[model samples]
Target chain A: MKIYHECLPCHLRTAVNSVMTMTEDESIISEVVEKCMQTASRFRSYDSLLEIYYDIQKVVKDAFPGMDPFSELKQNFNKLCMDSFDEYIKKINDSSDRFETALKLCLAGNSIDVMQGIKMNHDVLIKAIENALKQPLNKKVMEKLKSALQKSSNILFIGDNAGEIVFDRIFIDYINSEFNKAGHITYAVRGSAALNDVTIKDALMVGMDKSAKVITTGIDMPAAYLPYCSKEFNEAYDAADCIISKGQGNLEALLEENKNIFFLLKIKCNVIAKILDHKYKVDEVVIEAKTAS
Target chain B: MKIYHECLPCHLRTAVNSVMTMTEDESIISEVVEKCMQTASRFRSYDSLLEIYYDIQKVVKDAFPGMDPFSELKQNFNKLCMDSFDEYIKKINDSSDRFETALKLCLAGNSIDVMQGIKMNHDVLIKAIENALKQPLNKKVMEKLKSALQKSSNILFIGDNAGEIVFDRIFIDYINSEFNKAGHITYAVRGSAALNDVTIKDALMVGMDKSAKVITTGIDMPAAYLPYCSKEFNEAYDAADCIISKGQGNLEALLEENKNIFFLLKIKCNVIAKILDHKYKVDEVVIEAKTAS
Candidate 1:
């Protein structure tokens, strides 16, 4: 994907600092420390520390100009970036139904707060969708979706963070209005307390539950998800005719799965954006798959 | 301050989820939940749930139309506002050394990842900061900062989050550069990981230890420096000549303390912004203690 992370140092440092706070679990702390040691052992060949510092500089320079790179700005910049990122994340995360809204908010060329603070350019969105609609759909892909739906009756829609779920509502409404399927739609949310609230309660607040049956992804992120995701999401994924996975985090964990699913989200970061951009010229691309026949 | 948080439901749900993630001691989570309950009880007096919903909608719609009022966008907006605010804060954090690069970055508004795919905006921040900086500084407040520093030799700086601390480097540098102080500046980071990383390692990563005798805040945010922030920050707070706090979290925890401290941060959210706007006639206002006697 030719991914570029200009702020690896900051990210690495953040990871390490996060590890330090895990005094509650000595094993986890030791595990992280071991990873750090492994990284250091490989540092001779990789020069990871220097790479991190340079990446931090690159990211800092990209974000700000006319500043001496080698100065105390690193600390201030770190703090500012985290605070800004945290705040911006909130603006885009509007409960659970607005996952797509969150994705767009992330993609918008402003901090999360600015994008959230400002009104959505709905005209732009509607126009974009209209444009997408104008482009002739790949007959093969449409046929695949149709056949996939024919094979199964129930559908599971796995939500990403908060903002993007709003558009999910629109899609769900359209499906209900148009499709003559006998199955129900189960809307799934992230089970844990992430920066964005994608809980069942969040789903209810955004009224996604009212539109469709509500369920949790039944997994927490970064800690305890993989163990049960296969079982939890699998059931919803299995019974469903098709799955709709939204947002980067979902794509991160589910992109490789051999399932018939449609992924909806804005390619927010450079890494994923580049991959999707390569596949679909459009930055915010929707990829639909057909179950292996 | 007349604080209004319409996202209490989201907060409550998150608090619950966070509680589940906590170790055996669930006291902190219980406290946060209790507070949420108290807030809900208090708000029920002024408006019905529907009315409250509309009120939030009005503010969010005004800021970001087509954005669900109940979405995470509001929270992201709060982060942007806070990030914008830290720019000003870095200007006077330490009053010793000057972190020119950090200051420039803050002034330039190039602080965090904007998260756009390929279409990124470079001019938006310049305009936001230019407009923000064009406004006159609170003259009555500046006189107070100058006087307080004149009388104080030992300064204590309370850091809020990780990213903002980068900007704080500038403030610390300014303190070192401008002030002829005898005692050292003490930098306090959050003892534990409470959403943001402000641990000692984070303190060292940015070289804050070099600028001042680093200390942990010795208190957690909700609990006020439990086991993490060392007892030193408390001792320093008692003995240090001046104190500077960055970010809303710290301010919320410490604003009422009758101590000589300068609170620097952007007015995030409609509630705080409204209060600051009403009390000071500006969306961003720096609150400084009356000149040290």
Candidate 2:
């Protein structure tokens, strides 16, 4: 019920569109837009995002017609927005909201700006409650969620996407309504839009604060752009009640990290779909780590 | 000087826009008319064209807001058309003309209807010719091209996308002009639109008759849609001294077929890009294969 990574696309689209609007040179903008579009198109391919972007000169040319040098940075930046958004949407639409919430909780750590953003979106958060009333809760997912709710005094929830935040709120409300004795949940947003980057502002836009504590990461993480990890993310990652990872980038980064994390997302790429032994249609998924004895 | 794929977008935009007034769908028609507002939001994710029809559930929801299925489909179909046009623009603008042409050529093996659809678009082909004239020829490709022109007494040239046929014409024209010995270059097109389908009509739409012989594939092959192996295509594929294949689909179907083919296209997928060790970008790519001789 907790909406996690589903809210990512609107934020990503907003950022890219904002950048597209601000870029002054038509040729460069066009080139950059094309690069971003090409990057976006490759999401349908069965390749890693890194492999997709690897030596992407030919693809860039396909996207941008007449190109010069200065447009390269802009193109890469535009690609950042698109790549992140694609993964964010994939995760949010097809996965259990629990891991999504867990991801947000992990990011929030203790950032107040992030929390305030979630708080402001209370009205939006309630929209999910209305939707929840309409949708029959799946017995299996609900059982795991209820158990997690029972075990944790402080549950960290990761957030994704914009519109789906309303849906995510339903999960938290359900916990509060039916299991008030469980614990307080901390919601986390991305420090910046790294693949699954969700901000407190985004959390507010979708109304996350109406039911939970919210926060953000303390540093800017770029693995979302490139595949390598940084020191800051590793330390911040180590401190969490439970880490919920959203979207492909987060999943790729954390998939082998051996952390106590739950992954929730839609399998968008053939590579991931192959990994999950699923087809390309959107579907919800959830994975929880065995609690440390 | 020869206009390559670089000149394809402007030419295609003009062609599609010219007929934008004639499209049956009002919304898609209107979207085509919007000079600068095209988006990929409409047609990006469908696995097949059939899905376009089945997507009525959400169409009614978002387009009609609170409307029922019937009313929403009625309203949204119009919107869908515009969205389709938008997606077309995105595809054309973002992809290299050469690559697009290659895709179209590969598609020609899909179905005769797809081939005919390409033939129907005359306006874009004319514009493509004008654009190709503006660019200098790639010497390396041109050399191989020149040799093909001389060595082959008869040629089988594959056609690609809407705007790309003009570039194909450049090769055909050069071959005839320089060699002056071949009977004619037989241009082949797709039978359907599965991924990358081209057809004879597409060859003619770009005025293939003016420069070479036009032929249609007999069978509809999704993974390898080539009519050449058929009675109709084999006659042409066999009679021709050499064969020219365009697009990724062709490469997918033909690359390992152990046939004699000079493949012309921009490497569009990771599989090929990785094989070539080239960064994925839109550029002229010519791969030569001899039939294990």
Candidate 3:
């Protein structure tokens, strides 16, 4: 989760993807890319890679304010997933392994970011779902999550991206229906737009707040990096008995936190993938859930 | 040839590849990458894309002294081509169009840079050669080059990369033999190691200086940017009746120069690629040798 050598080029590519979509002005593109690099160069050795991207995001925001460069992309992705929501729900409803299906569905959702390798299409989604269903989850951790959920009255589900949130809604609904804790769930998003991560508007659009109380991390970091979060999110993080941390970003920021947490995400980069000993490309998903002492 | 928006990300990737090979130390890697970014950021808007890379290269050299990060890669490519070079020559000799074959071989060689898309191997080289032969040259320009070579005695041939220089030697030899100007050729290289560009030592290694007087641009810029060239190179460039500019770097720098320059290279990027209306992605070769009347 700390800065890796490979992270440098990756940061440049991300900024390039952002500015490329933002404007066609060559000068602005050059300046924006340089600004991102210069800003990242100032990051301390202890700073997480998440902070580096967050700072770069600021450079883009400052250059062109109030315009979400990924707005159209996010909307398109949301619609793409939502268009098949009912069919997917019916498929899950009829499936023998609803929990496993929902968990895999959540993992497949993390594979939506354009900057990342995952392509956004229905076939790609179906492929990911099939792959995840066949791929074994960490059985011990899954058992632990199920065991914890049996007694837990309150839960916090930290969601990842915009379109991905639609999948999370399905899983959360499944969790509430199967485990029967509908009214007690708290869903968290970023305080503002961070990469393709969801905000309040996206959550509302997808009606993610329909079943659970929606909250913000308030830190604006890509993941829910807690040290910078507002008092409310931190209190919520402390109060939740079972926490479902979505995406690699949350896993990075909250890996060693003294709380009950489950990291449900796709291993996107080699650095973290190596750490997990996950010998798969960005196409693979993993589920690791641990309980509080 | 001017700086393009697409060029920003590419420059970062080049620096990343350089630093990745230079050292494994993450801190140093991060530092060097940032330095390259800062160095490239300082380049004036009017500077060609090649200058951006040249400056970034300086950053790498400063960090790692007396070592060409691409030295091993360059040598491997040279040896790879040189291993089958005799066979290639035989094929060219057997062909009815020795000049065209040699010219395509040279273009195929241009595909050798790792930063650029050419994979290092005989198969890739052979494939490139086949594609070049089948693909039609700018016929009008090729005819003009033939006419210029017949009328003019002295030609300045600017070489590009180290491995690609081997192919350049073959084409130059064909020019010398066919045009009966064997002693009238001067092959120019960079004064210092700029990326994978050939220096006098590399030229000598490939025996390029043996047939012709091998000279330096006397400038550390990526290509023959004559504004910074030594007095000797400028005189040679000025006096030559025809100039054969190899590689996109040379094309970017020499495009607007008022000289009878034959730009023999592949369009590597979208910015220049779009301008040429070149439909292929980094695989096609372009022959644009215009005589200054």
Candidate 4:
């Protein structure tokens, strides 16, 4: 999945947004976008469509210099999601199908992403979570996951963003309570800061320590780019019986990988939207079942 | 008026679109977009946002070599407008305020544009013209124009695109009947092909020559970049009694000029949309009165 012409504009916008967090100087933002555009144009092809974002991340890092541009945004987003933790937990507990409800909550968390440059406050997050809860989801995927857990032991749940990871922890709690003997869940987050993707520190901060074993892939990409992953993450990937990949980034990275990977994400961006044969938006919950291609 | 960061993506898209029309070879289209992206990145600033299109136009020309990328699109759009020419004329004649009716018809024609990459067929053109007529306009500007025409001569009407110019000709006919003393309405078009903008050849083909003196700026820009305009066009600009600039391109070109120009355009693009405090679209009729920065 290379940078299609449709994707170039978004890359510019995302680059602008990332640098904007570092400084108010429009000149610097403009220059950052200018450079990103130049680099993006020369691309023969990328590892995946999501690799276009790495091009933007590189330029933002160069301009800002060791600063995590989205740090404050990530913190705010985390706090925003944290405030709703009790409400979300109560909602799940109240639902008849707690497992499916928890899964939907996790899908809802995918919208709390800043990649598209939308400002997501507490109200927006709550509304998104509520909306995702109400929407119909593929029941077959939920059944498949349950059946897989019955036969499998190692479940690697790749977490996406910071605030969203709290919701992932909720799902993990539900799984642990229901399938305690089925598998041990290892939550893999981003190794470092790329966009607003969570790391081990974020997982611990969000109290994943109480729910599951949280680790990082040792690569900052929002996805598990397996080649760049730490030996620990690769070993975990190889050993995992059921791989629950979160977000479009991980979906892009592991699209063709030979594994029992259930892509649990809200369809974001046209590239993935078309691939999934769904309408393009951040709201659509896509739970695709695939074996290592 | 400088190129906004928002404009970069459109350039890439338009560049790709221009090349795609030339060949289905994705490699060529991708290469053309790549080169365009590089060229566009180096821009310190442009005269206006519209000037950025010139860069795209240059790359398309370079890649395709003498092929007018918009030629087939231009022909289809021209025919689309021509199909409804008699209908528009009849509707104008049947209207109570024929002058305003004709002006709105011309505004409606502006949507038959290629720059935004909308596929304008005959049905779309008719619907647009109808919609433009039914909507309320800034009648104060219409009143102002009537007063200006009362004192003016040499009404240098700057035409926009090929098919859309059919609507402009209808307005020209109305002006000839109403304000015959406003001197000869010299219709100026593009000297050569740039996007779907009309040239003298297009004006002659569309019968604009019969209604008024048809001339060109001897430049391929969709707008009158007065700095790059021919001596003939500049003299026409200086000597004109009143300039009825058609479309957003001409409006962008002569926004703060010394002459009393009535910008008769359907506001296109965000740059102009922000400047005029109009929402971004091609539906509204904006008749702005400006002179001497």
Candidate 5:
């Protein structure tokens, strides 16, 4: 989605927060913030926030060389999710509809996002998962997604954050085992570190390869802006009969794509919530399908 | 006070909000926001937020010529406070210590600030006043102020916002009648419109002239930065035996000033809270005395 006036402050806040995560030095933080503002000054209303965020990441990377600001956070959350994987698996196994439960779990896992600046812990994640499960998903959208999974020969499941990838694996595994036995499932992660998003290392750590084929978008950004992504990702994106876009970032990047895409996300901010539908409140679990236009 | 990293987003948010108040045109808003960002990019660690805010306001004023973005809100809040003046007077009269009650009411009136982005109404302000009255002021600081008021030959009361100025009149009236009968009181307001802060017109609108001599600082910004203020204000500021710095803006601008200034304000943000004393909490009414260095 294109940047909104409201997104300007959010962009600056995210830039400041990312820099803060890298260093406590006031001079360095001020310098980085000033540069981010300069970058923001040039932004047009038509500019995508995700692309601009990549520029902000570049500023922070330049300030603190060879440092992934969210590295420790990514590792911590990945470990947290991995440790809780057995509990989630049991919850899915105990549910009447395993696919639905796993999908909800995946949506719940989106809360582990460091970019949102939410203080996340295992207890908080567990509580969020339980709350998400209690909230009902749109039956029509759910049924459409299930039907698509059954019919599609190839499915591309784009992953988001590190901890969330563990839950994505569960959903992918369930779909591969029960619904899409004849189809191939491909999981796409980010090429480089982008606000605790899943990388090849995180995907492997979460045992995602056991469920589906893993690949990187190679865009070195948070979102899969198709033109900039690796040829392999574009091929997978184009060849896929069905696309499962996870998290707000991916949904924002691919919102206007003329393809069969199902969006599964917890609306993290008012900007995305308004874009999807004004009636959809922030933190609401959204299951929406955007068919080829 | 010098700008904090946390203030960067706040500054951008305020600029956007102020522009939004002026015009609904998306392109106009975008253009103004971009300009504000450009101005912010040049900000150094030593830069005061109030000064940067003036530049942001300039961007907005340039975009929408001869417009006061907060005119309606300021007028509304001023009328609201004026209408409720009698009610506050009655409460003060009913209290044993009328001066202290009036002082607390003035601190509570700080909540009507538009820059804080808090939704304000009559009921909210009334409840806030009641709460402020219930909260105990620092006795030692209050005693110091009272003692200063009794002895001072010339008192300079720097006013803050439009709605809050009505409360300032009450406190000034009380001090003149009960303690500082022989002393001269000078009320200082902003030279022009700056984020709903009291201007010469607002001061007159609230009947400030009847209570004390009202003068503009000649600095168009919200804060009374002495170097930029009028010669008349500087002379009054220097000659005053005691200075009553009202609200966070005045406190911030004059925090380092070597003078007998008593800062009477509601701690608005964490930045101010830390500046005053890290132990102090946001929304706490502070009565602090700073003697000449």
Candidate 6:
């Protein structure tokens, strides 16, 4: 989706947060924020928020070269999730509908976003996971997704963040093991670091390859912009019969695409909520499907 | 006080709010916001937030010429406060310490700021007034101000908003009638409309001239930037034995000035709170005095 007027302030906030993660020097932070403001001023209404965000990220990278500010936090979050993997798996297995429980778990994991400004500690994540399990999802949509998984031969899952990948792995494993009709599953991550988004290393560390083939989108931007994707990713995207797009970033990048995709995310901002016709509010879990055109 | 890094996002928010008050056209809002961002980018760390805000206001004015977007709201708020004027005066009269009670009401009226993002309705203002009266003020500072008022021959009262001036007039009236030692009183408003601030017309409309000599700062900025003030205002400010600087804007503009000024305001943002050495939080009543150098 194109940038909304509200997105400019959000972009500035993100720019400030991103720079703050790298340094504590007031002058440097001020300089980077000023540069980001300049960058934001140059943007037109037609620009996607992801594109604008990418440019802001570039400004931060230019200031602090060779530094992934979120790396340590990402690793800490991954370990936190990894420690809870067994408990989540047991809960899913004990649930009445394992598939639905696993899906909710994946949505719960979406709350571990560093850029969302909510302090994401272990206690907060646990509370979110508990809430997500009890939170209502559209029954019709869940049934539709289940039927699609049963019928589709090829599945592609686009991952979002570091800690979220662990839950995605659990969900993918459930589908791969139980759904005989579900064929080859391909998992896609961002080519490089983008706001704690999972890369090939995170996927490998989480042992996602045990359930599905792991690949990168070859675009450093947070979202899967089709034009910038690697040839291999495009081939996989085209070949897949069912695609699971995760998080607000991917939802924004592919919201207008003519593809058979199911968006599973926790809406985190008013911009996304408005784009979704105000059917969802921030902190609500969204399970929506878009038919192939 | 100089601008903090956190103030940049606030400036953008203020810019967006300012433009939004004028028009609903998305393109125009986006254009104006972008222009404000560009203007904000040019600000130095030494610049006051009031100066940054003034420049952003200029951008909005340049877009929508000859329009005072806040005029109608200002009038509505003034009437709202005027309707409750008798009741507020009764409350002060009923209190044992009428001077302190009147001063508390003045601080309570400071909650009617349009730029603070809190919806300023009659109900909200009433609640704020009730809370402000009950909220604590530093006893030492109050004692100092009372002692200062008793000795000062020339008193300068800087007015902030339209609705607020009524309350200020009540406080000034109480002081003038009750304190025999208190001397000539002067009330200063913004020369022109500056974000719903009290102007000459508002002062006259609210009968502020009855209690004190009404004058304008001759600068349209929300804060009283001393360098840009009219010769008349500067003379009044210099001659005054006690200057009552009202609201956060004026407090920010004159926080570092070596004057016998008592800042009577409700701290509205973390920037102001931090500048005051974290002794106050947002929405707290502040009665602080800065002695002459």
Per-residue lDDT for B99 in model 3? 75
CAPRI-style class, candidate 6: medium
lDDT of 4 by residue, B190-236 (tens): 97888788887678777888898887987888889898899999999
Tell me the chain A TM-score of model 5: 0.94
* Local lDDT at B59 for model 5: 88
TM-score of 4: 0.81
Provide backbone clash counts, one per model.
75, 79, 1, 3, 0, 0
Candidate with more favorable, higher lDDT: 1 or 6: 6
- Residue A237, candidate 5: Cα error in Å is 1.5
What are the root-mean-square deviations of the candidates from the true structure over C-alphas? 19.7, 20.1, 4.2, 4.3, 3.4, 3.5
Predicted structure with the largest lDDT when compared to the true one: 6
* Per-candidate TM-score against the hidden true structure: 0.39, 0.36, 0.82, 0.81, 0.87, 0.87
lDDT of 2 by residue, B171-206 (tens): 465456656844567887655332223445445544
Query: What lDDT score is found at residue A10 in candidate 3?
Result: 72
- Residues A1-293, candidate 3, lDDT per residue (tens digit)? 66765666677677778788888887788788768767766655436777777777788888988877777778878888888899779878888988877877777787656656466788886776677667778778778877777678888999889888999999888888888888889999998877788889889888888878999999666789888788999999989988999988898888868788988888877767866666455556777765556
TM-score (second chain) of model 4? 0.91
Which portions of model 3 miss their true places by more than 4 Å?
A: A5-9, A16-38, A44-46, A87-102, A116-155, A178-181, A256-261, A264-293, B1-9, B25-53, B90-101, B116-152, B177-181, B210-212, B264-267, B274-293
**lDDT string, candidate 6, B209-239, tens digits:** 8888999999888889997789999999989
Candidate 1, residues B1-293, lDDT tens digits: the string is 22233233333333334333432344443343334334333443433332332232233223333322112322342344445445555544533423333333332232221211112233454455555444444666556666676677788777755444554565566656667552477778765444343557556665677777877765433223322345666677778777776655555555556677776655544444454445543235345342344
Query: Retained native contacts per candidate, as fractions?
Result: 0.00, 0.00, 0.30, 0.57, 0.85, 0.59
Highest TM-score: which candidate?
A: 5
Task: Specify the poorest-scoring 10-residue window by lDDT in model 5 chain A.
Answer: A45-54
How well does chain B match by TM-score in each candidate? 0.57, 0.49, 0.91, 0.91, 0.94, 0.94
Worst 10 residues of 4 chain B by lDDT: B277-286
Question: lDDT: which is higher, 2 or 6?
Answer: 6
Higher-DockQ candidate of 2 and 4? 4
Which one wins by DockQ: 1 or 4?
Answer: 4
Q: Write the per-residue lDDT of candidate 1 for residues A63-123, one digit (tens) a residue.
A: 3343332123222222333333434444434445233333333223212211122233444
